[model samples]
Target: MRILYGVQATGNGHITRARVLLPALRAAGVEVDMLFSGRQPDRLFNMEPFGDYRTCRGFTFVTDAGRVRRLGTLKQSRPLQFFRDYRCLDLNGYDLVLSDFEPVTAWAARRQQVPSLGIAHQYAFYHRIPGTGSAPLLKWSLQLFAPVDEAVGVHWHHFNAPVLPPLVAPSPYPLTEEEGKILIYLPFESMDEIRYLLRAFPEYRFRIYCNIPAPETQGHLEFEPFSREGFQQDLCSCAGVIANAGFGLCSEAIQAGKKLLVKPLQSQIEQRSNAVVLEQMGLGRVMPSLETEAVEDWLALGSGTPSPWPDVATALATWISTGRQVPIQVLTRELWRAESGNMLSLC
Candidate 1:
């Protein structure tokens, strides 16, 4: 069967998930094409897995100094281009269109009267799960942004719902974490501010990944451009992670057993909610902004236990190949056990 997979390219999490699913789908003997939206195609890197992919000027949230600005987002979004692209996209000859919280393919599948399945963490919001952004408007935006007929939500826990555990890819290198090194990936914050923030903590080393022209290392801090190999290497070796409260990186930190300190982007319900849930679950520490106090507090704490990442990609691929006729709970439990690898059950 042929499938068109839609991935939201506004952030790295969606792309990271696609990396896991693309190979799994191929191994399951499913033919698939990919479409990325929200970010420009040139900004995407280390995208070797999706073969040839398509892109569009889909909507993206605009941020200023670590906060999402709703007004700016609307102003920046080229609605005319988005509409034209959506209307022109052809979805013929595809057995299914899978949306990973991506808008173009989701809308196209609906307009063209084709089967669409939304397999994403955002879909978990359809259920009464924890960590939902509070504002009703944000809630509505989540629903309308990526509309789909069928939903397959993924989360860190089942929450006694049909949600599956987070899709995490293991570190490609051996896990030899450096106790004094930390990985910083706060894309929304300014690099100069980050450098200033870490200056006080001269004892620890900081490796930051952001929109740098090239690699540059200074006293106590190293700044590098976005490279998948380099970023993963730093993450695997780092003793801790300092980043925004994004799902993908948090999942990676947990899987890799790295100490985590997160600052949720203001005005983003998802990030704020993620922070609350992280504190509630005792998974990580959260600060509203990148302040020195939070960093000091986090440094005083120990590296807590990280979650076990399940091999949901392959199992989900199998389920898709089998027509998704059975309830996903059966597959959810199957994959949850496999994630545990006979060590622990998700609480």
Candidate 2:
């Protein structure tokens, strides 16, 4: 089947999901044409996986110093262009549009009455999961951002819902505990603030990945430009992770058995909810801001236990390739059952 996959490129997490699933889809003999939005084409890197992909000026949230700037976000949105792009998009040949919280293709698929499937952590909010408070705007955005015929939510826990486990590819590197080393990825926050936060822990070494012109070192802190290979290597070898509560990075940290200290992006419901669930699951610790006291306490914690998530990309790829004949609940049950089995084996 020919599928037009739409990815939200505002953050690396959504793209990360596509990176995992696209390969599985190809292996399953499904043809995929990708469209990415919410970020400029020039900003994207390490995109060897999705060849000759398309980009659009889709919706995106603006942030300033780890807080969502509502006014800034509204000012940047081009509703006219958005409508034009979706209306102009030709979805005739594609059998399905798989959206990862990408609005352009989702709206196009809906307008054309084509089948669309939403697969992302945000879709997990459709169910009665944790950390969903009385936030009307959040609710509206979640529903209106990317509506689909079928929603497949992914999360760290199922929460007694039909949600699939996090869509993380297994790490290629062997897990190693390099003590006193922590990998920091807080793309939404300022580098100056992060530097200040790290100043207290003089003994510990920090490898921060961000949008820098080049690699630089200052005492125990090392700042490097975003590189997939370098980041993965550091992640696998590091003792822990200090990052914003982005689903993709946190899920990867959990899989790598790295202890997590997350600072949720202020005003973001999803990040706050993720932090709450992580605390509830005892998988990680949370700090509302970059506080040295919290970091000191978190640094004293022990190593994390990795979650036994199944190969969800392969499973979803197979399901899509075979025409999605199986019920979602059945797929959910099987994946969770497989996870349980893995947990038992580990025990």
lDDT by residue (tens digit), candidate 2, 1-347: 99999999999999999999999999999999999999989889999889999999999999999999999999999999999999999999999999999999999999999999999989999887778876646646777989899889998878778889988899879889898999999999988999989999989999999898799999999999988889999999999999999999999998888999999999998999999999987788999999999999999999986654689999999999999999989998888878875432211
RMSD of candidates 1 onward, in order? 1.7, 1.8
- The window of 10 residues in a row where model 1 has the poorest summed lDDT is 338-347
lDDT string, candidate 1, 12-102, tens digits: 9999989988899999999999999999888999888778899888888999899898999988998788788888999989999999999
How many pairs of residues in model 2 come into backbone collision?
Answer: 0
Off by over 4 Å in 2: 136-139, 342-347
- The superposed Cα distance between candidate 2 and the true structure at residue 61, in angstroms, equals 0.8
| lDDT for each candidate structure | 0.85, 0.91
Question: How well does candidate 1 match the true structure in TM-score terms?
Answer: 0.95
- Model 2 whole-model lDDT (C-alpha atoms): 0.91
